[model samples]
Target: MIDLAPWAWILLAIAGTVVGLSKTALPGANTVSVAIFAALLPARTSTGALLLLLVVGDLFALLTWRRHAHWPTLLRLAPAVAAGLVLGAVFLAVAGNAVVRPVIGAILLAMVAITLWRRRRTTAAPEGAAHLGTTLGYGALGGFTTMVANAGGPVMSMYFLAMRTPVKVFLGTAAWFFAIVNIVKVPVLAGLGLITVPVLLMDAVLVPMVVIGALFGRWLIPRIHQALFDRIVLILTVLGALYLLIP
Candidate 1:
């Protein structure tokens, strides 16, 4: 069994709840959960453990938003995302926790800046369709961050927002994107010895919290104004990033 302090368990439970809420309603908020898990567990182990809980959250998101996904966009992003996953796997194999944590923090901060800049530049729809360069850049970054530390939400959220995706469509597309990407990561993490019997057992205990958060997200999403929702996600994302950076 995995040993954890009482306070750690309490924090993990809150993190699990946030994972579900992020999937179902707030797209970038899971960065906070990632920060919590990483703080409380071994960095690499936390990635694997959080990935399982995220997959569970992904399922609920998919069920709720599957119909809203934009397939063409997903297809466009596929190749770059795959390349990024491979790169991330390589990075994970060699980097220690000391290195990984700071890198994750940097990526999150960068994404937040990019998101704010993009939002300021345009409330209008993206000029023409998404360019190939833009697609590849966002796809690869999203894939790499997600694979390394489950921090892809903010990166891809910025991508969708830059494209001016409507709230429902954005949720749907992101739901499918993360669902498939996260599942693909399972075997890679398992091969790294990050996913193990104990991790699964721990996740089993936390699954219900994820479900509750998802349900809560579903109820809350429709009520939030889009502008307010976007600000909240970005602000939470910044805070999460800072947590990783601080000792």
Candidate 2:
């Protein structure tokens, strides 16, 4: 088994809970979990361990929001996402976490800024659907960031915000997207020898916290107003991105 200090375990448990809450309620919040895990473990190992927990969280999100997914959007994003995943895999094979993390942080910060600017464009005509180029750009970046650092949530959250998706639809589509994407990453991580018995054992200890967080999210989501939810997500996204850039 991999050894960790007591404090590390506590941090991991908190991160697991945040992962669940992020999946079900706040899309961008799990960046905190990604930061915590990477801080406490080898970056590659942390990515694998956290992937399993994210899948568990994804299951909960899918169960709650299955009926709300918009398949056409998912389909439109697929090709670019696939290209990004491949690019990320190659990058991971060649690079280290020190390089990866900062890149992700920069991308997230830029996306947040772009999203906010898009929202403020009062004179822009309403685009009924996201532009193909926009979808591909965000999808590719989301896939790349997620593959390297588990930081896709905020990237995609910015995309959805720019698109002006309804809150429920945003959550629902994100739920489905992550669930499928996390599952796809499993074998890739396993091939890289990142997922192992020690990681699984650690995850087992942390999963109950994820369940508790998911339940809390279910209860809390309906209570948040749309405007407040939007602001909260954007603020958290910015904070998470800044945290990544700091070190």
Candidate closest to the true structure, highest TM-score: 1
- Ten residues in a row with the worst lDDT in model 1? 119-128
Local distance difference test values of all predictions, in order: 0.86, 0.80
- Regions of candidate 1 where Cα sits further than 4 Å from its true position: 224-240
Writing each residue's lDDT as its tens digit, candidate 1 over 1-247 gives: 5899889899899999989988888776787788788777778888999999999999999999899999988999999999999999999999988888777777778877876776676666476578889999999988998999898876787788777788789889999999999999999999999999999999999999999999999998879776876777678767767877886
Relative to the true structure, candidate 1 reaches a TM of 0.91
**TM-scores, in order shown?**
0.91, 0.85
- How much is the lDDT of residue 139 in candidate 1? 94
Error of 2 at 159 (Å): 2.5
Q: What's model 1's lDDT at 80?
A: 97
RMSD of 2: 2.9
